[model samples]
Target: MHIAVILKQVPDLVEEVEVDSQGTDIDRDSVKWKLNEFDDHALEQAVLLKESSGAEVTAVALAADGVDQLLYAAVARGVDRAIRVTTASARTDAPAAAAALAGVLADMGVDLVLTGVQAVDDLHGQLAPILATRLGWPHVSVVSRVSLEGTEAEVTQEYSGGRMATLEVDLPAVLGVQAAPRPPRYVPISRLRQVMASAELGSAAAAAAAPALGSTVTRLAAPPQGQGAQMLEGRPEAVAEQIVALLRERGLVEA
Candidate 1:
């Protein structure tokens, strides 16, 4: 079987975020980019499948700064192929990304497509469902595990309240992976460097343009700071009395 994993780059959250001059997006130029954490799990699931079932795994991503290194790391982690799509856009634009990827993936002949269930940057919509809609393929979200037998795939979906359901789908389906069955393995930086030197990533032109969403961001600003936390250092009874008095002041309790 052939599996294709979708990878995305996200801004490292450790850095301070600044709004762009347009007031519609973050200042991408000011931040460093890294692989999406959820996508890392998706890649790990794909690699696990490749190891267990002898499936061919392909990692696909859009061209961006540090994306080549991400692809090389995927190679070191057991991806058989890597393809970079030629396009430029703010990573938050999920609709455009889904449209572009759907067009390109149409001709790949892959049996399964795996993507993260959600991304920190993609607040518009998750990519996997939208991509599946564009491709007219079956899609399942919040999938935690996947296993294949013949032309059918069994997947475990996690739901709220600590619930899980297993379902089976025929081949040529897309899954929004919440997690892999196991934690993602670590690849040595030296191995990644070697792959970077030896591996060549395939490139493809985006076959479709991103469609416009029906809305626009007119303004962006940081949230206003609130009063800092109050420390309660007293006896248990005193603390309880203080908490009840505070709640009463806020009308949270009957005074």
Candidate 2:
């Protein structure tokens, strides 16, 4: 079986975020990019499946700063192939990115497409479903585990309220992975360097253009700070008395 894993590079949250002059977007040029955490889990899932079933795994990513390193890193971790798509614009919303990826996935004979349920930057959780729609393939989201037999796949998905549903999906399906069966193995820097120096990388042209989303951001601002915490320090009895008084003062308790 051939599987394609869509990888994304997202800005590390530790980096300071600043809105661009347009006020609708972030200033990408100033941000430090790293592999998206959820995508990291997705990659591990693909590698695990590949190891267990001898499936061919291809890691695909859009062209971007530090993407070559990410691809090489994947190769070092045992993915069989790496592909980088050429894209003109960096403003890839979930639908636009899915559209661009659809073109490349169509010709790759991808029996399974696995990616993160949501990117840290966008957190919209829209890419997998949209890509499946574009490909006319069945899709499952928030999938925690996947098992394959012959041409059928069984996936266990987690939902709100601690619920889970296991679905039997046919081949040529898409899954948005929420977690991997195991954590991703660490790849040494030397291994990554070896792949970067010698491993082959493939290139493809994405959809000619991305359609614009219907919405726009007018203003961007940080969330308002919450009320600061109050400290009660004393002997146990005194602290307890203070807490009771404060709660009664705030009408949280009947005096």
What are the runs in model 2 whose C-alpha is more than 4 Å off? 123-125, 226-255
- Provide the global lDDT of candidate 1 against the true structure: 0.89
Candidate 1 local Cα displacement, residue 8, angstroms = 0.5
Score every model by TM-score. Answer: 0.87, 0.87
Report the lDDT tens digits of candidate 2 across residue range 52-123.
Answer: 899999999988778988999999999999999988777567877887899899889899999998886563
Clashing pairs in 1: none
Clashes of 1: 0
TM-score quality measure for candidate 2: 0.87
The best candidate by lDDT is 1
> Cα deviation in Å at residue 44, candidate 1?
0.2
**What's the distance in Å from true for residue 234, model 1?**
17
